[model samples]
Target: MNKSELEKEINEASERIKTRQSEIETEIDRLGEQISKFTNWAWIFVWIGAFVSAFALIYFICTNTEKGFGLNLLGDFMAGTVASVWSLAGLFFIYVAFLGQKQQLLNQQLEIMYSQLEVKYTRLELSGQKAEMAEQNKTLRRQRFENTFFQLLSNHQEIVNGIDLKRVRDGSWTTSAEGRDCFSTFYERAFPKGFRLRKHPIEPTVEKYAEFYKVNQSDLGHYFRHMYHILKFIKKSKELTKEEKYNYSNLLRALLSSYELLFIFYNGLSEAGKPKLKQLLEEFSMLKNMDFELLINIEHKKEYKEIAFASSEERKKLLRTKK
Candidate 1:
């Protein structure tokens, strides 16, 4: 059964056990009351028996003691009768004492049962407290994770804002672009318009990316490294599920401008990003929102896995069509 149904069953069983315990206690009380009444009646019987026996002995002595009855004989008869009566009364007292001891033992057993029940209830309460504490700890962990995640996101945006590019002209530098505009300027410079296709496009592409990266390493290096760490942070988190990691990565992806995505696409193929950053890019599907039309060569898309550019649903559809 599911958790709720199982819990319901356990609760019902506990209630049944409690009800049975109560019934047993009630029965013990009733038995105790009967025993008390019987003991009281036994005491009355003992007293009545002693009184009747005394009266009979006195009547016999008065009626049967005639002329020539010896004093010694009469004294012997009275002693024997008194001894028998005392013996009978002593037996009745022993039985009454036994009943009293039995009642005491029963009371002790009831007390022990009550104590055991109290301990079980205390254990159950402690278990509930532990579960509540565990839930609170989980909530705190989630809050801490989200705080760090959003802070890193904000830092990434700040880094993007600080980016700028200057073009060299006649021994002087002029600011050619700033912020997001710098990415487009870098892309145009790296991949000139109407460039002839190389025999091996991959090598030439990497060379172009390396050269462009060297020229603007200071600005681009920090941006790429920060972006890579952001994604890497999400990937390394043990707290997040696969879907949660994907959603967080998508949130970071949403902040990137089209030119920024274009720059990232080529960056991942270059030497600087191939080892670690490229894998993280594909894992998080970082290029899922890239505009294919922006690429200098559309065939460059084939270098990465299909998952890098397509969403899960789109990938599934592609798979079905291939099949």
Candidate 2:
């Protein structure tokens, strides 16, 4: 049974035991009164019998009609009467003693029962305390994971805010863009109009993206690395369930503009992100919300696995199918 139900049962049992104990005590008290009354009556009977025997002996001595009535006869009569009276009193005392012993035995049995009940109650109370501690520990673990998770999220935002890109025209810098706007410039530089007009092999596309990325590595490298670490942190946490991880990753995904997703989509195809980031993207469905029309070549959307863009239910169905 659950803790509350068990505790309630114990409380009810305790009440019953207390009531029984009170009843036993009252019965012992009543027996004591009965024993006291029996002793008093036994003493009164002994005194009355002694008085009658003495009066008969005195009367016999005073009204002796025969000279043969002697002291020996009177002595025998007195001895027999006194012995009988004392024997009756002794039997009454013995019966009272038997009742007293019976009451003591009942009290002893009750005490033993009470001790056993106390032991069971103590054990149950300790079990309840252990259960409470386990729940508290679980709560504390979740709080710690959330604290670090949100901190990483905040750091990711700072990196995004720090990004800046400048456009140069006629050998002089003309315009500048910052934050989420910078990814559009990065995407345009990496995939120009002529590059998208003709169908290109995957290797050449990767190589071309790599060359453009090399030129802008100074601004892009740290941003991608930090982003990778954030996803990695969520993946490595043992405290989070699959659903919890998905929710947190979706929060990170929400921060990215469409251009940011485009950049990430291409980045995943390169050698830099292939080893780990690509798999993480699929695992979290990071591209589920990507704007497919924004890609330089719409067909590029098919390059990654379906899991990268599948909804949570779709991912589950895919997993079951695989199994």
Candidate 3:
């Protein structure tokens, strides 16, 4: 059953058990009081009968001795007959007392059974509560992961926009390095001397512009760091859905599909920075074979291929294969 249904069922069961236990306890107390009263009355009656029998026997012996141990009205069998009748009366009382004790014992046993059943019901109720708590914890964890993923996606927009593929394709941000060692001091030769901007919009296709061309650009470090953390989070997260992973991967692929943008970013990185960029690509597993031209052509078509569901581990495997 679903969580709410299961919880409701468990609560109902617990309430029923609690009510039954309370009723059983009430019955046990009632039976206990009744048994106590019966025991007291039975003992009082038995003692009274014993005392009267003793007095009668003593009087009979004293009065009948002078009459030759026999009564005038009764024969020699008179004493024997009286004794036999008294023994039968005592046996009847004993039988009645025994039956009362048996009834008390049976009630006590019934109370014990009820007590055991109550304990079992309590345990069952506790188990249900624990199960519900566990499910809630799982749901909370999944929700947190989803929130973090969306936040990262929102933050990465500025970084993605920095690499303007259209600008690179249209021959913007070009400068002259007319008579200098273009290969050795490309950065200095391409831009105006001693000119520095806080942010330069570096095109992704820097290879198309053979010389170092600097325009207003922002620091790409934050963007890369954010992307790295996102990948790591996906790798470690147990709660993310396969479809969620696929969507994240698809977003990365969309950024990479821009031919000039991908080339410029990869080509412009320093020797040390190249490996870090490669590592980032591997994390996203976006190096997989994706025909950008074909995708663009089919962008508005109904027959366009859909992104496939993939987990973080499965996405990592894509990095092992060359594009």
Candidate 4:
């Protein structure tokens, strides 16, 4: 579920609750109106009774006032008192009716509040679903990418290229001017540098590989491009020619395998990662009498550059144990 879905469900639930609340309000209103009508009629009847009694008592007093005029006047005063008391009773009933109406209004408001809470509950549920969906998509993509990356690795099985060169730069998402998110964060953190080497063309360095194994990146694209064009070739390997396939295969295996293997060896032992520096006098086959003393020269300040081609075996012999 997504945010909107939960919100909508909440809205629906609220509407239902509101509708019930409206019905309750209607019932309360009806009862209130009836109570008001009864109170009004009672007051009218009390006034009418007072009027009829006053007329009859006046007629009787006038016809038989030979006993005492003062007593007749007192009887008329008592009749007036009875009428006022009945009127006061009607007013009391009206007050009770107002109290009932107030209670009903309170109940209606409570119902509305309850409806809103239900809406909120639905919204929360939907938000959780959306989060779960996003996570699942990330997991699926990571699994797919891993399978594909490894598949390319298996086809091309070259060791690390010591002479290979690569460019390192920032993981600028300049192309994706839209914005960056967690995905971009992942990629940048994982591949902090962009190194595009020839022998290790579009390299994913040993350091970066180790990082990826530890956690998934937020995004795979940096500078709005892939790790290499090998990515495209990997995707279309089935349709690519043999040379294209081998190129991708070799690229992936040469860089990735060495990177992964290097980390594995590092994890297996502590000293394996950072060995004491050593130097070889000659990169080729070791000579016995040539310069054995140079091995421990301890002069690390030496600069040399060679621009030439060498076979795999020749390059291996050239790998002096870095001092």
Candidate 5:
């Protein structure tokens, strides 16, 4: 063949190769499109599986009613209605629970708003009442301070004199203010400074017993409550092994002995003093499973008779002063 004829044949072959490459790229693009379509529809399989599961579960529960399986028009219109009702009820419950929660949140928000409004009104009333007595602002501030001081004093009166002269010289348990007690020492150890006591008397606002009354029974309430807690602690602690419990009980006995002074002071003769003592006695009597005698006589730590030793005269005196 001549040179021109050979060139013409090569050009035709190159054109055919280009056409085949374009066709192959188009086929790859078509396959990629098919993959994307399948990915989009993959969620259908999940729903289909979930629906089958739900159907099976409902069927099994219904079939296995206490009376064995029933059939031959078993899935009648009534049965379908029952199934639908069951499904709807389940969905309805979920919906209702969420709505109830939403309603509770709304109620809580409303309560907060009401509380703010009440506090605002109370402040306004106080401000109005005190404005005329503005001249005595210093006295009011001082009274507020005194009220806190006396209130604290009454609460802590059970502590008696907590002065350990040796510790005072050492400055270990000593503070800048009045002497501290064992309870106070424990309190500071357990918590950070300025944390308030968990419990308080019922009448927080009554600064003192009214009308020329001496603060005779300062620690009466504190001691009574302190006894109750110690008893409860003993009861809970007894759940440990017998040996551990016995050891712990010995420690508890010592603590109770330390607190006996408070009990005696309560039982002493005074109107306020007598009533408070009676309450503690009543509380002590009602303590569940706390056989004070059982605890005291354990392994003979010199059976300290004073812990439970209440005389008949003291009992009679407490009993005589009734409501």
Candidate 6:
């Protein structure tokens, strides 16, 4: 009970109190960490429960239940202040489901678009093939026409080369002196006069020419037949293009040579042969259809003009004499 003994006892009690206070603080910190971990785990349970309740609500509606039993159960489990949080979680799940359905609809539309593209491409390919086939057929027909034209050229070699009437004077009518003199006059007159043959002659002028010459009729029949065949071939081929007409005209021009006026005046065989040949020549003479004025220009050239007539006056006089 002295003063020193009382001070020693109070100091020891103060040390013990300080140690107990530190231990209590450390235990409080550990408890706080455990409570935080439990709170995080409780959030997982809340999300799982919310999703299950939403799915149950959907199932009940689908099954046509009389009462909203699943919704009632959810309300009982998550009541008071926390019910609004659970409702928001259910709405979030519904929004996610809507997004999934929208994506499915977009995928279906894309597939339809792809199918349409494939069908369109196939149709285009078929159309191209048909066009190619049509072009090939056209080419074949054109080739056939060209081949037939070439064969026609080969068949009529003599009349196409031109007949020298002067050389054909050994016939029966030219045996007598009077016949020979008449034939000589006819031969000289026939050149420029025969060049004026009609494009649309109604009758064969072979009989008239032969009578004028006092010669055999057969002497001029070959020439008329040759010209007739050429015209017949042209008229029959109604599908001839302007180019083909021009080409055949050039061939006829070659046969006629300096006798450019022959086509304008020559009479051929048969009534059927007359007007058709006339119309064909008229078509050739057209400015739009052909460059036939060039043929006239060719005839007017020095060499052709000199061979047909020595002078324009002589030509006019000879034409007048014939008329």
Best prediction by TM-score: 2
lDDT of 1 by residue, 84-112 (tens): 65566666667767766775676566445
lDDT of each residue in 148-184, candidate 3, tens digit only: 5765665465455433222243566443322212222
Assess each prediction's global lDDT (C-alpha) against the native. 0.73, 0.79, 0.47, 0.42, 0.39, 0.44
Candidate 5: tens digits of C-alpha lDDT, residues 61-85: 7776765545434445335554555
Give the poorly placed runs of model 5, Cα more than 4 Å off: 1-215, 241-246, 255-259, 262-323
Error (Å) of candidate 1 at residue 309 is 1.0
Q: How accurate is candidate 5 locally (lDDT)?
A: 0.39
Off by over 4 Å in 6: 1-128, 160-219, 268-273, 286-323
Can you tell me which runs of candidate 1 are displaced by over 4 Å?
1-128, 167-174, 196-200, 315-323
Residue-wise C-alpha lDDT for candidate 2, range 1-323, written one tens digit per residue: 66676667667776787788778868877987788888887888788778878786887788676666666777777677876787788888888888889878877766666666555556565776666544544554565567567767876887888788767889987659888888888877888878867767567778888998899898889889999998998999887888889899999998999888888888898998988899999989999889877665667777788989999889888878878
Tens digit of lDDT per residue, candidate 6, span 101-172? 554454354444434433433343355554654454445345445545654565455433333334336553
Per-residue lDDT, model 3, residue 311, is: 40
TM-score computed on alpha carbons, candidate 4: 0.27
Candidate 6, clashing residue pairs? 197-265, 197-266, 198-265, 198-266, 199-264
TM-score of each candidate structure, all chains considered together: 0.55, 0.57, 0.33, 0.27, 0.19, 0.33
What ranking emerges by lDDT with the best candidate at the front?
2, 1, 3, 6, 4, 5
Score residue 119 of candidate 1 by CA lDDT.
46
Clashes of 5: 2
Alpha carbon RMSD to native, model 2: 40.7
Best by lDDT: 2
Name every residue pair that clashes in candidate 2: none
lDDT of 4 by residue, 69-154 (tens): 57566576666776666767677677767767675676656545664554466457456765654454344344344444664343
Residue 318 shift from truth in candidate 1, angstroms: 8.2
